[model samples]
Target: MPAPTHLLIPYSFRRKGILLGALLGILLTACQPRHEQAAEAATPPVGHYEGSLNAAGQPEVRATLDIRHPSPGHYEAEFTAPGTLSFVADTIVFSNNQLRLIRPARPGQTLALTLEGDFWRGALTLDSTRATTILVKRGVPTPSTYRAEEVPQATGSAWLFTPADTGTPGAALALLPDAETAPTAAIWADALAREGLIVLLLPPTDSATAAAETPRLLAAVRLLRGTAGADTANVGVWATGARAAAVAQLLTTAEAPRVAFLMAHNMAVGPASNAVLRELRRRKLAVLGLYGGTTASQRATALRNALGGRRGGTVLTFRTAGPDLLRPDGGAFGPGLPGAVVEWLQGK
Candidate 1:
């Protein structure tokens, strides 16, 4: 009466056999080479990269790349060569462990790069020749602790530079640079801060927003007094180019008493400027003028003539250092310029 041997196998034993087989398959897959497993979990490199461009018969250019991945298979890239050229890629592609950034334009160029360890190796092809480029992984630059802040009732922004210890009320300086000179303005702010003055850098604004200049400057002065703990009576206004003219006009208004000192650089003596100087003289404001000997000597002379009989007004001219005294990089000033400004500001 015994059943066939095959029929004697229990259903529970068959289920166990199937489960064991599946586990063995998974274990074998896990034991495969790590390289094979890594291929499935790969991620695109995303971060800041710094490098240089070397071309025949050209100055070496520093380059920085910023790469970002927003979603799967989507990327954004910005390439910058400071003081030379820069562009953002309209299209970015990453596939098969390689990255390609492209933007449609004339004199077409392409960047083909691959990540190798902690660095990226690439070639930038323009026209016919390819330039070898190497970019190392780097962290994004940390923003400066000294930073720009919007004035409560102003049109443009002001960068505030506070000393490490501003124990008591000190003099406040309002720095107004040319429209294209914020970087240089920051440098001047730092230099003045080192001399124990609270520096508020007001960047140039466009004509469309020009009407806000006076109120914005007044608000900045108040901010320096209330927030920065500056002596309102000792505040000064330093401006360049058209900004100087504007500051001159501002002083003619009822708020003239707010600024105790005035320094105007590269401003020409004209009807408008003359009127401003007259008002400043009437107010007994201490005024300092700096001009380039080669480029602004005539203007400087005219200004000196206008201020000849006025007390507390002085004009100095320097050769080779003109309006471009602030380097494009904003990291440096013309030779001896910083010392001169510091000396004048400190009444030395």
Candidate 2:
């Protein structure tokens, strides 16, 4: 049995074929680096993530994140925090095992995170504050049961609480929350809603920002007026602490909308507050001033005197519910405050 003709192929030809195949393999590998291929394979799957924000000296704030990858290297995110605050991040970057999500705006915020296996750890920077946060893949996100519905506004979002008895014309109350009083505002909204008032809870803004957002506040008033059965002629604003001053300024402005009454709690007597008192006096707007007994007695007295027995203005004093009522943690007077507010609104 001598070798077949095909088996008689030259050794050089066989060697050439093997060499060509090896060269092709090398060229294919050179086109895509091994590490890059591994990185592409190691990308974390996009889905829902649940996390908590931990800041020293601050209570833990939990968050839910919905992440989506619509195309290669592009991502979108929606983040919800306490008090049902939600914002969407259209700009997200993921590269080199790091992810960055930003809500780009003046006083913009950012979250820079790194992937470690299945976990993502990061820090959220907002304004001048930074807090540590971590997210892990979640099979399902916890449902939010916040009672108030978030209504977007030009300045920010407002929490709206409409009374069940919306068929009858009733007063529309704009409750402005102080920096630490969002929860209190919710409580107020619920209590006021039960009393047949349509409440629009304004999110807290810093004093400086509040001073500049008069037009936004006016817009919110317009939004509230547009609601069915809302008494546009009897629109009232209730604000406590620093925001009261801002509200006063807003009401006093030439472009300010018509506000029939104002309820201010624990408002300090200063340039802004003084201006507010003067404006209320000039307009003869119904005013209810709630003050803590010890700390604000003088200022409250000054406010009352400024009104000088204006027909619709009244000042109420609380021995225990002074400035602390403006604090988020101070809720001792919550149960009692709402009753007083209801009575005042009814009296109006």
Candidate 3:
């Protein structure tokens, strides 16, 4: 009777016992632990997220996560949208199944994240700039710390305080009393306060000689941005000079100095017009031009064609014409050309 068993079973020993049980089920799934087989192949979780427009046309946001572990790698998640981006909890870390997060900056940018656990599931990928960050991995789920807005400020009535570089902080100790100017730009603000560069002049919110010095020059442009990191603006055409050439001809029309001061060595301001230099290159600034006398090669050819387009904006000209050392002559430059455009903007 044993000889009758499947005609003596020799179909190559039943195809080597089903290929040795499929090579021991692919060597126990390649010996597990790739974030636990990507959290057991994203099982029984939840997910959904969405956003729109990017590829530089701007706006690309995301967030959709649904997970439930209740233990082990520990997780509980849900979201459809609620991420402006912020992180720190358990320093978030993952591998293979891939997930990562890191953000915390004590003075400027430091946002980060990595994605693909179904970016909010349907869609969510915001990145107006540096794109903030995001990610979710393995049993995938992420969304927490998405409420941190506070950037709606204006302090406007006029302020100007810029300088983090440009002729190296020579002018812009902030101004706005009709944006100061007169004779070579008011002796380039007294040779940029005798070359130490720190002036806070004021008087024109429509000066009746600024009754009691325009609230002490608008309290030094509103507390010099919590003191010395400067950079403030509340302008309508405040001076950088040819008397803010009609607010530098409406800063060549629109978006004037949201932050400006590029370079001015091949200098400018022959009374603002080429249609106010094309509305100051379509209202975008942060330009500076200086190249020795007579509007230096047309302020370095209209700041090299309005900062060479696609608007990443800025222009800082000076391959020469700003080192005559112990300068200030031509009746000491100022008292002549708007006090050398207010001592090259107070950095004299």
Candidate closest to the true structure, highest TM-score = 1
Best by lDDT: 2
Clashes of each: 0, 1, 56
Relative to the true structure, candidate 2 reaches a TM of 0.53
Q: What lDDT score goes with residue 119 in model 1? A: 77
C-alpha TM-score for every candidate: 0.54, 0.53, 0.22
Ranked by lDDT, top first: 2, 1, 3
By TM-score, is 2 or 3 better? Answer: 2
Evaluation by lDDT, superior candidate among 1 and 3: 1
lDDT (CA) per prediction: 0.57, 0.59, 0.31
109-163, model 1: which lDDT tens digit per residue? Answer: 5677888876778877655646667888798632222212222112333455555
Model 1 segments more than 4 A misplaced: 1-156, 208-212, 255-257, 309-312, 327-331
**Which regions of candidate 2 are displaced past 4 Å?**
1-147, 153-156, 209-211, 271-276, 309-312, 322-336
Superposition-based RMSD of candidate 1 using all C-alpha atoms, in angstroms: 21.1
lDDT of 2 by residue, 122-149 (tens): 8877656677888888864333211233
